[model samples]
Target: MSFTLPTPTAAERNRLARLFAQIASDAGTRVMEVYESNFETRTKADYSPVSDADERAEEVILARLEQDLPGIPVLAEERASREGVGGQIWDAFILVDPVDGTKEFIQRKGDFTVNIALICGGYTVAGAVFAPARREMYLGGGAAEVFEGFLPGETVTQGQKLVTRAYPPEGLTAITSASHLDERTKAFLAARKIAGQTAIGSSLKFCWVAAGKADVYPRWGPTMEWDTAAGHAVLNAAGGVVTQPDGAPFVYGKGGEGFRNGPFIAWGREPV
Candidate 1:
């Protein structure tokens, strides 16, 4: 129930990022292989869909995290649900969403991603998201400023550093969840002055905003801590912000809500 927290030194952070990127990329590959095959989907207790890909990918990532990081605790989506980690508090831990955007993955939308993050002091220190179907991977936070490129491997370098563009002078460009869009989101956009919008699935919205492809992503519906932690870190590393409606920084470790997130906005710039 207790362990020494890893020091967040620069070298240590880089090592962690490399290990995490490899894990994410491997997990993503597993997901894509499943995507290419005839996969079955089953409904979970929460009525959300789960597939063989989710379990297989999480098992791969979890085993690596456990073997490599030893004492560091991990709060992965599939395992945590059965282990009840969502209801416990930890000073530092790894949060993993082995497959985000399951609905998109099931639908073959190619919007799903494999997410892994290090959360310390209620903030994500580093994170990585790999979209195998899209052949793209993003890593950010801590010593690694946000970056995007193919997943790190034998040939590719780390990646190009990512920076969110300045709020467009013309107007704001927003991206919303392709499948989860609701009236509240539309109303939020209507009330605000925005020029255009894009609908994409999964945590890719956060990556788009972080990569300067969009300005803001407002989510008024429910999400879990695992759903946003990795993407939140990527956005933050690229000079973006994710905050509650009241504009406070969105921190994790929400044991009270069982790690479920309330509505929040991921902005390319600090909201005025």
Candidate 2:
């Protein structure tokens, strides 16, 4: 697939931001409507959990993105394969995870999120994770200071900033999915001698590192590009490393190829 234009202008940027924010907020509304309800969930062929909330939220996202940014292509979770959109090595694309932490959402754990990322030149320039269940949004990139805005309330000022908690050395606090931590990730942590671990869901794992709430996140399980792009942008903006142990920077636009990342780490500071 051919790449789109370069970085968007201030006006265009704001438009995209607002569109994404609107979609995310709408998704929140859709999810919260059923957050406490008895929405049914079913197992995918791979045994992954999915609910109507996921499909509905993705529909809202796809509609808004297509209407607002017609030129830009969307890689939404539900539309990935149906659209025949994942094979090409495009220069730019919109990566979306309509409902991450589906298990958390299903269990009413309030850790689910809607993750969106702008991938260009094989890197995430703008990413946002809206935890609608918790009414918190982690938005970073496009400028300094990872902004954490509480929902239906205040907003982030253009100039004021937030940075990661200083990287810790006493013991690394790793974050994992409460219900989805796989055996490979567990073994990797155990063999690598990670000092401690905590469990949360969705892109919050990346936010944990960005906010200095935690130090590192190691995962060996299979993850689609949407799952990490937004979080990756936030962590990178906060002066953190989202790279392989071999020291190469994480690159996107690989689709189902390019190793899709294996046993990588998101560190708040230099590894010891």
Candidate 3:
């Protein structure tokens, strides 16, 4: 059966955002456990690396999602890699990337994250991203109700509300992917008057822009919905925008493309 739950109210969206943050924190703890251990890595059918941390953390996220928000479909990375999500359009669903930035996780770079997002009507309505090793958590929902917090235990506390900064007159500070920087991305940056750039793995690029740590993030390479949905939601709530190269709205639920994502640019604020 197709699951098409109605979008939650603004109050409910904020509540779900916090709930997602807690869930991401729980999954992140499991990821950290695997990170600290002697973990084994294997290559997926697509030749991308998958580690025990990915699977273990996904287990936590899936279990929690099932308990907290039952009946909603979940499109998770690990499970999707194993059992492909058939071509079924969904009006609403959850996207989970239990251990985003596996390369960073494998390299012990501490840039990996646990991501959970709620997508409704082809938009990311709520999301949470937790970087356990960095002790950071970000949540977004409602209109401009984005927050960043520290997770000391199972809860996220002392949340500092976040908003995207205005574009600086000097130039843009761009964030790029550490592992997937392609020529098209390089060419895109080369054309811009960039003041500085930082390369990081996973969804942190979107969070950096949302937090106003950077002005833009341009990815010309391939990504999956689970890779961008949560971060996109956080950025959107923080007064940022993510769109196509031509400035079109970036949308989700591309079941025809097998949930794969096209290149998109995320901006802290529109440049003049």
**Which candidate tops lDDT?**
3
Candidate lDDT (C-alpha), each: 0.82, 0.71, 0.86
- Clashing residue pairs in candidate 2 (N, C-alpha, C atoms within 3 angstroms): none
Model 3 lDDT tens row, 244-271: 9989889999998999999899999874
**How close is each model in CA RMSD to the real structure?**
2.8, 3.7, 2.5
lDDT of 2 by residue, 214-248 (tens): 88887766777888988887787676878765677
Q: What residue runs in model 2 are displaced by over 4 Å at the alpha carbon?
A: 1-19, 81-86, 144-149, 152-160, 180-195, 256-259
State model 3's lDDT. Answer: 0.86
Best by TM-score: 3
| Candidate 1 C-alpha lDDT tens digits along 1-272 | 12225447645555666677788877877787789999899987778899989998999999888888888878889887666653688888889998999999999988898899888889887788888888788877553344344642323256778888999878999999887888888888998879899999889899999898999999997798889988887888788999987899888988878888989999998884
Q: In what order do the candidates fall by TM-score, top score first?
A: 3, 1, 2
lDDT measured at residue 74 in model 2 versus the true structure, 0 to 100? 72
